[model samples]
Target: MLTLRSFEQRDWPSVWSILEPAFRAGETYAFPPQISEAEAHEAWVEVPAATFVACAPGGAVLGTYFLKPNQPGLGSHVCNCGYVVAPEAQGKGVAYAMCEHSQREAVGRGFRAMQFNLVVSTNERAVRLWKKLGFTVVGTLPRAFRHARLGFVDAFVMYKELIA
Candidate 1:
């Protein structure tokens, strides 16, 4: 069974194992492809309200996620998050579970909705998964993300209203 746990010092290495390739790929997230470990940690771990690890009974981390405000002031009612699953764990539903959990967690934390600001259109797996999870691509920014392999690609602004 998979379980979600608050980030701990021991979780850093495993978290990095998942994040590094994603960051290096520069495909999904906006982080610089060459971002260093400390820099990546500052951006991924230090800034979010909370970080979590998806762990197995043996304590192996399969994925990680972070939750934060989608924007400031008037936009604070919406939450934003990012997920990274271990390469070995891909296609096994780790991201889906994290997205579901994050929505519940966001609502519990008083967020009225959730927004994904820059979901790469080329990332069909994530786009499909988020849609299946009830989020809508309310808007799209053409050629917004420069996917490492795809050059410039469109990105979507996905949103889900959690309250009313």
Candidate 2:
């Protein structure tokens, strides 16, 4: 079983361990591959409205995610989130669980919708999973992401309304 909770200062190291490789891979997130720990902490923790961690039974972190407004002012009703799961925990349901948890948290925080601005097209698993979770591809940006290994690739703008 897994548990999700607010991020604590002590969770930074484990969160960074999970985030470092994925950010370095440059395959999914748009962050610079050589981002410094301080820069990453500022982006992942300081900037977001809230951050959370997913932990195993023994309290070992399995993943982390952040939630923030997709835009400011009138657009703040829509939120954005980024997720990263430990490599060892991949193929499990960590991402799915975190996503579901995020939606509930978003609604509670007064966000009416959620938007993923740059879902790299090459990330088929994430695309499929988001679709399964009821998000729609509202638009596609042609050659939007310069994937680490695939050069330039398209990206999708995925969105889902949390309330009618």
Number of the predicted model whose lDDT against the real structure is largest = 2
Q: Return the TM-score for each candidate structure.
A: 0.97, 0.99
CA displacement after TM-score superposition, residue 102 of candidate 1 (Å): 0.5
Q: What C-alpha lDDT values do all the predictions have?
A: 0.92, 0.97
Candidate 1 lDDT score at position 136: 99
lDDT of 2 by residue, 1-164 (tens): 99999999999999999999999999999999999999999999999999999999999999999999999999999999999999999879999999999999999999999999999999998999899899999999999999999999999999999998
Clashing pairs in 2: none
What lDDT tens digits, residue by residue, belong to model 1 across residues 43-128? 77899888889987798999999999988899899999999899888899899989999988999999999999999998999999
Sliding window of 10 residues with minimal summed lDDT for model 2? 83-92
Candidate 2 ranges with C-alpha deviation above 4 Å: none
Candidate that would win on TM-score: 2
lDDT of 2 at 53: 100
lDDT of 2 at 5: 100
